[model samples]
Every structure is written in C-alpha cells, then in structure tokens.
Target: MVTITVTRKSQSFVAPSELTPSEMLELSAIDRVPGLRHTVRSLHVFRHKDAADRVASRPAEVIRAALSRALVDYRPFAGRFVGSVVAGETCVECTNDGAWFVEAVADCSLDDMNGLDYPLMVSEEELLPAPEEGVDPTSIPVMMQVTEFACGGFVVGLIAVHTLADGLGAAQFINAISELARGMDKPTVTPVWARGLIPNPPKLPLGPPPSFQSFGFGHFAMDVTSDRIAHVKAEYFQATGQYCSAFDVAIAKVWQARTRAVRYNPEVEVHVCFFANTRHLLTQVLPKDGGFYGNCFYPVTVTATAGDLAVAGLLDVIRMIRDGKARLPLEFAKWTSGDVKVDPYELTFEHNVLFVSDWTRLGFLEADYGWGAPSHIIPFTYADYMAVAVLGAPPVPKKGTRIMTQCVEEKHLMDFKDEMKALF
Candidate 1:
C-alpha cells in the first residue's frame, strides 16, 4: 500500500484585499438542492519535471498570493452559506467571511505518490482542506490546501461548498488563481452570479428512494478508446441514421451493463439520471453573458425496465439517453415558469437508479500556473454504486475517454470491466 504523511505548516484566511467588505449573496434553487448542500472537492497534482528545485522552496507563498488576488472578483467563495427557514422553505445566505487556506508538506516525492497501483488507496483527507470542528461550513464556502512533496513537485486540492459553485464554476475560480500566478492582470472570463435566473419548483416531493437488497460494491475504471468510440459512432449512424457523441455512446453502454451486473429483477423499473450542461444548450433562456458561475445544469432522469435495458441494443440506448437530454429546453422553461412541479428530493438515489455525468468537456488540464498544466487530475472521492463520472483520458493520448464508477460487486465489477472492453 502507498502511504503519504502530510504535515500542516500554516493556516490562514485569504481575502481578495484588506478593504473588501463582507456581504451576502443568495444561492439559487438548484444550489439549495438536498443532495448538493455538502462540499465538492477537486484534486489537482502538478509534477514539475524540470523546476522542482525552484518550486519546492516557496510553493505555499506562491499559491497563497495567487489565491488572494483571484478572490478579488470571486469574492463569494470567501463567504459562508447561511440558511434560513422561510415559510417552511429553506433559503440560502452567502456571507463573505474569507476562504480557508492551509499549507502542508508531504514526506514523499510526486513520483512515489503517482506510482501506486491502486490509486484510490491513497488517503484523500490528508490532501484536501476541510472546515474545522465547531465552525459552520457555510461560513467558509471555499477551502484550499497546498502540499509540497519532497521531490519539488506539489499538489493543489480545493473543496468548495456546493452551494457556492458547481464543477465548472469551481474550475473558473481555479483558473483565475492560475492566471494571477502567471502574472495576468485579470481572469480570461468575468465572474457573474445569476442564481435568480431559475425559479424554485412549485412543489417539493416528500418520499424516500426505492430500496434494494444488500450486495457487493466496487469502483471500476473503463476506457473508451478512440477507435472504439469511432466504431460506436459509426454503428449508431447505421442503426439510427444519425451520429451520436462519444459521451452518448459511453453512457449508454455503462447504463446497459450495470443493469445486468446488479441482477436487477426483469420486472423492476430502472432509471439513468444524467446531469446536462445548459450553458450553451439553452442559449435562448440563459442571458448572453455566457455560462454563469453557479449550477447551470439540470438533473434529467430517463426510465426503463431492468430487463428492457439488459436486452436493448446500443443504438436504442444511445437514442433513449440522447432524446431524454433533448427535452431539457422545454423542461427548463417549464421549471423556471412554475409549469413543472418537482424538487431535488424526488431525484434521490435508489437501487434501480444509475446517475451519469460528463466531465470530459471541462479543460481540467489547462490551469497553467507558470509551471505548465497539471499532469494528473484525480477525484479522490468515493462514488456509490449508482453513479458514473465520465472524464477525458490522460493528457497524453488525448483521444480516449475515462470513467470512474462507484460501488459494484466484486464479481460484477469484473463482469462490468469485460463488458466495457467488449463494447470497444
């Protein structure tokens, strides 16, 4: 097993400027979703191939200074999430309190950390910073950690209160920090808060998700190679008379295989829920300012029977997923205008539910902070059995797809792997 020991060096609250006043920003209805109230973390590891010696000397100071400047425009991150019960509904309060920053050192080289065979075994808590006990999490929506390794390379881990931003929004903030580190006067994209853009649902659903019998759980990585993706696209075109994206192909396959792996009863209902990006998808609905700095996508669910999914052809599954996504525009309109009556509670996870999200489009490798882009961007968080995170392949080949799934049974995990390889 690979082990890393991290020693805390310094801790502080970094504000954009000494004169920046404290203020409160309200969170959107999407941000206040039940499942999304917790913190979401991103782990970025940069290996300094040539300047390790120079970087090791002042890693903390460099990142801290950059972060302070980056917070100037993204001041909301330096605030807390305040909640109040208004007429039986939960409302969010965002108050500027300064983001928590921690500096640490690991007694290992970047090579040593990366050489582990089972990457998930490494302890995530030691790498990322979190809110201290007795301190309210909402008070510090953003927290960061800079860990210097013995080999001169370093790791940057960030945890943001989900109420503050989504994954893309978090990337924007990090990129801004990187821009400042590289001596840029300002970020490439301006930050904007538009939570009121989407109105709350008219009614909230009160119910627990369906239940399933206990079973084995495992995490597996599936590769969607360039050639394999091309083949799938071609097959989809032939069968459906249309082209589908790599994401469509990959998600359909996983959803199909998972139904079989878990031995879900043929008569049981199953759902594949997807998180779609509406930044560009709903150009007519969103303001022309471009993707705002908050949760912009909606969780859309598609339903089918386990037996149906198990037997359905790939093209059909692809279309099913694609068509479900295509309806988001009308859904968004209905949702914003109170025509739709749904709440986050209704989207809870269950045995028959499989959630799929695509992170491949986000440029995780491009946050260049003077020392070039990161070599590895790993999600050190554990996923439950009913979830799939679709990410782009490593920086090298740049043509394949990578996925990390949560909680599959031991035997089913192997079968899932084989199924994925067979699809390619």
Candidate 2:
C-alpha cells in the first residue's frame, strides 16, 4: 500500500470578486431540517494527462480566482447559517463573509494512490477542510481544499453545509466555478436565491433533537459491472414484462444482500430510505430554466420485514422501490403543507435502516477546471451505518457502477461480499 501525505501550504478565505447584496436568506423547511444541519464532504480527482497549461501550472490560484467569481452569484455559500428568530430553525445570513480555501500538496502521485479511487489510501481529514477544533461547522457555509500531486494531477475536496444545497444543487455551484476557471464570462445557469418561494409550515415547538449511538460499521465499495446490471434488467423485464432503471435494480440488489448479510431476525422490520428530487413537482413555484438550486429533494422510505426482504425476489424488491419512488410527489406536498414531518436524526441506529443516495446523475464528474472532467468523484466519508451511495465509476474501458457503503460490521464484511457476489 502506498503511503500518502498531504500538507497544507496556505489557507485563506476567498470572498466574492464583486460586492454582493447583504441580506438574511430564510431557509425552506426542507433546508432547516435538523438532520441536514451538518456538513457533507466529497473529493473530485483529476489526472495530469488532460491538464491544460494555466491550470496545470497553478491549480490553486486558478481555482481560488474562479471561486471568488462564482461566489458573486452563489453568495449564500459565502454566508453562514444562524439561528432564526423562529425557535428551532436556522437561516442563512448573507454577510458575504467568504468560503474557506486551502492550498495543499501531496507527497505521492495520483497513480501511487490508485488514481484516488475507492478505499481511499489517505485519511479524509487530510484531504477535506473542516472547522477548527471546538468551532461550529455552521459558522462556515463552504470549505474547500485543492491538493496538488507530484504528477501534476490534483484533487478538489469540498465540505458544504447540507442546508445550503442538495447533491444536484452543489453540482450546479461547482459547475459554475468550473465555467469561470475555463474563462467563461458568466455561468450558463443563473443562480436563484428565492428561498421564500418554497412555502414553509407555521413554526411549532418540537421535541429535543434525538441522540444517536455509534455502531461498529465499516466502509466498503463494490463494483457492479454494466453487463451485470443489463443482465438483471433483461431478466426482470422478461419475467415481469416491466421496466426498471439502473438505480432501481442496483439498490434493490444491495438492500436484499445487506438484509441477509446482517442476519436480522425474520420478524424484525427494516427500512430502505432514499431522497427523491421534487423540482418538477414544484414547477409552479420554481423557475422553468432549472435554476432553483436549493434543498429540493425529499426522503422516501420503503419498509418490510427482514425475512420478507431477505427472501423476496429481485423483481419484487425492484417493484417495492419503484412504488416508494412514486409516492414522492404526494409526500412532498404533505411535507410542504406541514401535514407530515420527518426527523431523519430521530431514525433508529440499530442497523435496521439503510440510507441510499444515487450520485451517478448528479454531474459531479462533469466538473471541469480547464484540465478536463474529474477522473473520479467520491464522498469523503459515509455519515453513519447503512449509508450507501451509488456513484459513477471512474472512466475505464468497462465503466460500471460503484456502490460505496458503510453498511455491515467488520465481522460480517466477508459475508456481505459473498452475498453481493452471489447476486452477480
């Protein structure tokens, strides 16, 4: 194994290039969700083969300049989240503070680190930026680090508060930076900060936040070849005469394999939770040009007994997932009207729940800073047990799907692998 060491050369705040508005931006209920108050991190790796002259010579300077320009429009990211006057809620105070930026250098080349692929060779803390010890993360809306490798390759690490944007929204912000880095005068899509456009329920007192307990979870990644996915879809269609997407079939397979590998009691109830984008559902409120970049995705869950999921046919699981997805529009409506409330932090941590997110279509891999698109994009770390992310695999001859997970215990890791292999 190659030992990787990243040292920070400089750290500073990159403010907007132009003076921007200073106002408090009220967050939508979805944005103020207690569960999303934390920060999410990811890493985008670029190889030296496609590096352009300017970016290859001074990656940090180019990105920092681009970031300053990008913040002029996406100014909320340059602000901090503060407690709202309405108790139990938070809002973004657009003070035009700036985003925390770090310039770093790595001791090893991208090749030595396996092109910064799955099972990352270095610690996430070393690559990603974070608030200083004892400091609140909410104080900083965005944090980024650019680590240059000896091979002229580089890695861009980002830490953004979930309250600011969901996966797609964050991608839009990154794409804006890339556009500027490539010398575009302006972003293709204009940013919209109409947070009040999304109606919020009346403020009501709520119970204390739920306390969570840690589990002995281990992170794992598995490659499910494109051929295997196609084969399963074909088999399902032939048997049931129905169509299923790659996400539908892939997640169903993981849900089933994980349930079996955990060896849960036959009667125990288990849940598969995933967020569904609701931008289309809010067409009346959101812009038509697809510029409303905020937290627009809502969580949807499918529940069944452990035994049922373990023994259920792949087709049955796929149908269950599809059915759950079909409920997003209605569920989102209820959520908007305050008819229902979901406190994700209140979810049980007994390993009976699986949180799945699909990143293949989020466009993170499409972010280019003059050097070409990233070779690989991966979450810095899974938030908790049974947190599964379905991501696009690095460019390769086959180029399949990569399932990154922190689902099973160390003892059951081998069993989980065996179960996943049995399916393929």
Candidate 3:
C-alpha cells in the first residue's frame, strides 16, 4: 500500500498548464460547466475521532491539497467555484449550523463533543436535504464550511456536486487520502477516465427529457434528517446451515421475493446495481506507489425485479451484487454504471430509483480520525423513491447494531417498519 505525505508536499499553487496530464485531468474534473450537477453533488461527511489529535494526519493534509488543485481550474465562478445557478450556489461561510457536511474543520476540537454530544443526532427533517429550488443551477460544487465542536475532533464539511459521482465515489477518494495520511509510499489505485473506451451518451434513439418545470424546479424536494441509525448485522446461512454474510442474505431474500413477482424485462432487463469500491482493485496490483485519479469503482448491476428485492435471502442478494461487481469489465457494466456513456436522449433512461446497499458495502467505517470511529453515517435523503440506502450505526453497549433506510413514500416507509418488526 502506497500513501502520500501531506507534510512533505509544498502547498504550492500551480497553473493548470503547469500540471502533468493526470493532474490536469483532476483539475478539469472540477470544472462546473453546465449540465454536470454531479460535479457539485453534496455527498459524504467525515468525522475525526480525537479532534485535534487527527488533524496532523497526512490524509487530512492531502485532502486540503486536492481542494487547492481543484480550485486552480474551477476557482469561484463569480463568488463560487460552480453549481446550479437557479438554486443559488454560494460558499456560505459559517462558524456553525445544522448542515450535514463531508469535512468540518475547526480551529479547536472542543472537549464537550465527547461521544454522543458532539456527534449530535437530530430529526431527519433537520439534516441536509437535497436542494428544493431547481437543483440551484448555481449550487456550489463545493460548499466549504468550518466550526468548533464540543468534542476535540474538528469536522470538515465538503459537499460535492452529485451529478459527477455518487456517495460511493466520494468515499473512495477519502479512503485513498487516509492511506496517504498513514505514510504509504503509493496509493491503492489510480483513477482512469477511460471515456474513450466507452460509448457516447444516448448511443441510439431517445425522447425529449422533462423540462425544468417538470422536476418541480427542484423546490419540492424534501430535506434529509439525522434520525439516529439502527440496524442488525447477521451472517447468511445455506440450507445445509453454512454461514454467509448478513448483507448477502438480506439482499438475496429481499430481491428474490421481488423477482418472483414481476416478469423480468426482456428488452431492457431489470437488475440491481451495487456500487463497489474499486480503489483497491487496480491499485493493489501496481508495483509502485502513485495516485489513482479517475473514479475507479465499477457499478454492480444485477438483473432482478421489485419483488426480488422484497423477498430474496440475504446471501442471494449479496451474491447478485457481488457477481455484478465481478463482471465490471463487461459491456453491460459500462452502459448502466450511471456514466452517461450513452446519451439520455437516445436511451430515454436514467437509473430509475436506485435501491442502494449501504450497511455492508463499504469497509473502513471504523475510519478513526484519531478521536475514535464515528457513531453513525446516514444515506442521502434528497432523492425521492429513487435514492435509497440502509445505513449502519456504531456498536452501543445495549443496542448491539442498527440500520437506516429510505422508502418510496411515507406509506412504504411505514410498511417497511411493520415488515421489519414482524421479521425480526
């Protein structure tokens, strides 16, 4: 494992022309040219365990470096780097607020934030919700904010534009930085755009997309909240009584039940897309240490039905998701991993309602920024029926484990709660 040291690198400012091809690619990645709201999607929040103690970690320094590099090209476009203008993007500076952020840097990691107090869990309504105001054409690609916390650990807030990549992609970058912070000579993976290898967006036929007004101008979107996380982690078992991962079994049973209900789509084919971390996939194979720049993880897209997800066994669901990952290099993986490799006008398709697997997919949840691990990590709440995930909480003496989830609507959410109680 190779990691870069933040302390060793000069906090130097370099023009884009001065950068290597790879560096330039990274710089360009942040440009908020219109149509790439993902370039500004706000996903992922980071927590430091011991506040001040983890500040010196090389990973933290590297993150700062990356930010500086991004600014070289995507510097504040008239006050902000880039974002949905209709929604009003701004680097809203703040000493403190309830916004959920990726990084929360503060001058002092206060002592009062010890345990539950600092990692405050409020109602879901109070958490960061997706922008309701027309995806704010000017929504800042990066919303930088810092504040003092009761705990010694300072929080750094970074909200990436969601159109570019999802939460899974953001997590990969963070983990890579952690590797560097630990002083690894080489990073785990190198990012590759590989755009040339894929097809253009809308590869064939298509239709007119909904106008901005059709999306309710992004105002009707609900806000995400911080309801305390709760879940149960268990291993999968076969009929022979052999044990498997709880995630595998849970996914299997849920989707399996759904598969039995709906007739599988023959033309488009219904499947589950599991987003896996690809940082280690290619990087681990390298002999030298280096930074992997482009987004690496390949989305796992397994075909199934709504009924399949609702009634499949844990092991089966895990198997389906894992299998999709195993075949990333396949043509199918490229078409549906959320990359607009094919133009939407041609396919008339978008990832229709993502059923995300949150709890067991990502490793390093125990990422200790020196203070200690986080008490919890919740899923994005801005997306309606489409974006859903089951989050896991840290172990508490009495609670053991817990899970978080999003539903299609209020009724489905309540139904799920009922199902969970009956099953558990």
Candidate 4:
C-alpha cells in the first residue's frame, strides 16, 4: 500500500478580478427542488514528469493566479449561499467572497500512488480543501486543493455544491480554469445561467422524505477493465440480438451482483437509479450546442425485487434501464411546480438504493491545465449515498473505464469483487 504525508501550506480565498460580473446568483428550481445539502466531490491526479518543471516548482502560485482569473467568469463560485431554509429560496451571492483554496505537499510520487490497484481514499480527502467555517459550505459553493508529491506529480481535489452543477457542469467550470492557465482567451463554451429554463417546483417539504433517510453503509471499490466491459456488451448482443451501451451493461451487472451479494431474500425490494443527462433530451429548451451550464440531468429510477432480479437475464436488465432512460423526455415534458411532489432527488437515493453516475463521457481526460491532462481522475467521496462512479481512464495502455464505489456490507463487498472479475 502507498502511504501519503500531506502538509497544508496556505488557506485563503480566491476572488474574481474586478472584470467579472459582481452580483448574487440565485439557485434554479432544479437546484433547490430536492433540498439536498451536499457537495459533489472529485479528484484529478497528474503524474510527475521532467517536462513539468514549471508546474512542480510553483504549483500553488500558478494555480492560484489561474483560479482567480477563472473566477472572473465563474463568479457564482466566488459567492456564498445567503438564503435560509425557512426563506423558501437559497441563492448564491456573488460578493466576490472568494472560494476556499488550499495548497499541500504529499510524500509519495504519482507512480507510488497509482501503483496500488485502487487509489488511496484517505489521501484523496487530504487533497480536498477543508469545509468552510461559520457559514454553510454551500455558500462557498466551490472549494479546491492542489497537493504536490515528492516525485513532482500532484493531485487536484474539488468539492462543488451540487445545487450549482452536475458532473458535466462542473467539468465545464474546470475546463475554463485550465484554458486560462494554458493562456487561452476564454472557455470554448461560455456558461449559460438561464435558471428559468429548468421548470420550477412547488415548495419542497422541510427535509428529505422518511424513505430517503440515511442507512449505515460501508463503502468499497470494484475495478472494471475495458476487457470486462466489452465482454458484457458482447454477451448482451448475443443474448438479445440487440446492442447494449457500456453504461447499460456495467450498471446492470453491478445492480445484479450487489443484489445477490447482499443475499437479499427473493421478495426484498431493490432499486437502481441513474443520473441521466438531459442536455440532448431537452433540446427544445436547451441550446443545441449544450453550452448551457448548471444541473441538467434527471434521475431515472427503476425498481425490482431480489427475486425478480435473480430470475431476470442480462438482456432483461438492459431493457429495463433502456426503458427508464427513454422516459426522461416525457418526464421533462410533464414536469411542473407540482412535480416536487415526487422529487427525483429523494427517489434517487432512497434507502438501499444503488445510484450509478457515468462520468466516462464527461471528458475528464481533456481537463488539461498548463502542465498537461490529468493522468487519473478519481471521485473521492459522496455524501449520504451509496454511489458507483464510472470514470473514463486516460489515454494509456489499458484504454477503459474504472468503477469506484462507496461502501456496502462486508460480505457483499467480497462477493461483488468476485462477481465483477467473473464477468471478464
């Protein structure tokens, strides 16, 4: 196992320059509807290279300057959350309050860290900026940490308020920072904050519904190689005479394996929820270029019983997921303020739920700062939910996807590992 020694260097705020817009940015209905109070966290690891002498020597100064410039365009991130729970609207105020930024040093080299089969979760957290004090973290909206390793490599950890952006939205923000760092004029896709584009929902209930309450779950990770994914897709095609997407197959397998791993009784209910991208699905409302940033995906959920899943074949599961995804357009069409009555965020993570987020298509590998594209992108943590993050690997020998998951039961963890390996 690789060990990491992290030393926090500086803790400060990075505010936008006078050039960027200065005003309060309100949360859209999509952001406030679920009343979810958590940040979506991500990590990007860059390997040390002799060529990256500039980045390694002054990592903090370079990143801090770039972040300040980037914040000028993404000023909402520099703002703090102002509205209260009882106020009915919680908005982000762009007072140029600044995002919490941290700099750190790690003990091991990039190879030493990646040498392990699974990335170190403990070290990943250390690379993230500490949560803000005095005010709600969401107010800060975005927090970041850049940690340089002994071998010249470094990792960047980010925690963004989900109310602001989903995976893609967050990627867009990072890409902008990267572009500025690389001396580009601006991001290729300028962020669009047409919050009204997302239909507003009626006043939400006070807290997460009873069914959405947290359950003690142990987190774990399972690696899925390109070969394994291809094998499953081939199996699906042969069995059903129809093609299946990598995501459809990978998610189905995890759902099936996890259901069986836990040894749930045949009649026990189970659910699989996917965060489906709606940028294309809602073209009528969204820009064709899909340049509009903010949360644009909807959670598409399918439910079953342990017995039902046990009896179902792989094709059956794929079809189920397909159908659920196909319904997003209709869901959006029928959406209204009253739709909050069935808030998807609550349904997205109801107890015992298997929530899968596919980041393979999100272009994380292209997230290049001045140094170069990240060698590895890892999701460090998820709040109050058991999640499986499917990420795309960098351009390398293996050319595949990596599945990192939050904890489940101990026995189930072993079973899931064995089951995933057997798929190949």
* Number of the top-ranking candidate, with lDDT as the measure: 2
Which ranges in model 3 have alpha carbons more than 4 Å from their true place?
Answer: 1-36, 39-140, 163-169, 175-202, 207-237, 240-244, 253-271, 276-290, 297-354, 357-373, 385-387, 393-402
For model 2, state the Cα shift of residue 100 in Å: 0.3
RMSD of 1: 3.1
lDDT of 1 by residue, 88-147 (tens): 233433344577999999888877865222354467788888667798654477889998
Model 2, 1-424: lDDT tens per residue? 6777799999888899999999988888678777677777888888886544674357888999999999999999988888952354788888888999999999989889878776668887888876567967667888999999998889899998888898899999999999999899999989997778876765555656454656677777888888989998898899889888888987898888888998899999988888888888889989888878888887888999999999998889999998998888877777677676544323444578888888889878889898888887877547554345455575443478888778888888888888888876
Q: What is the lDDT of residue 311 in candidate 3?
A: 54
lDDT, each prediction: 0.71, 0.82, 0.37, 0.71
Report the lDDT tens digits of candidate 3 across residue range 1-424: 1221111112122222223222221212212212334433222234444445446543334444444343322222112232243232312221111112233233223233233231343222222333334644334433432222433333333455643334544454545444444445434555433323322223233335433311110111111112211122233333324444444434443344333322234344455444454445444332234332333344455675555455556555666666665676554334434454443212112333335455434433544333444444444333432434443444222232344443334424444444444434
Per-residue C-alpha lDDT of model 4 across residues 108-156, encoded as one tens digit per residue = 7767655323635364557788865676665678998998777776778
Q: Considering TM-score, which of the candidate structures 1 and 4 is the better prediction for this target?
A: 4
Candidate 4 local Cα displacement, residue 34, angstroms = 4.0
Question: lDDT at 182 for candidate 4?
Answer: 70
lDDT of 2: 0.82
Regions of candidate 1 where Cα sits further than 4 Å from its true position: 1-3, 51-57, 85-96, 115-118, 136-139, 200-216, 281-287, 380-386, 395-399
Q: Distance from true position, residue 388, model 4, in Å?
A: 4.6
TM-score of each: 0.89, 0.94, 0.53, 0.89
Two-way lDDT contest, 1 vs 2, winner: 2
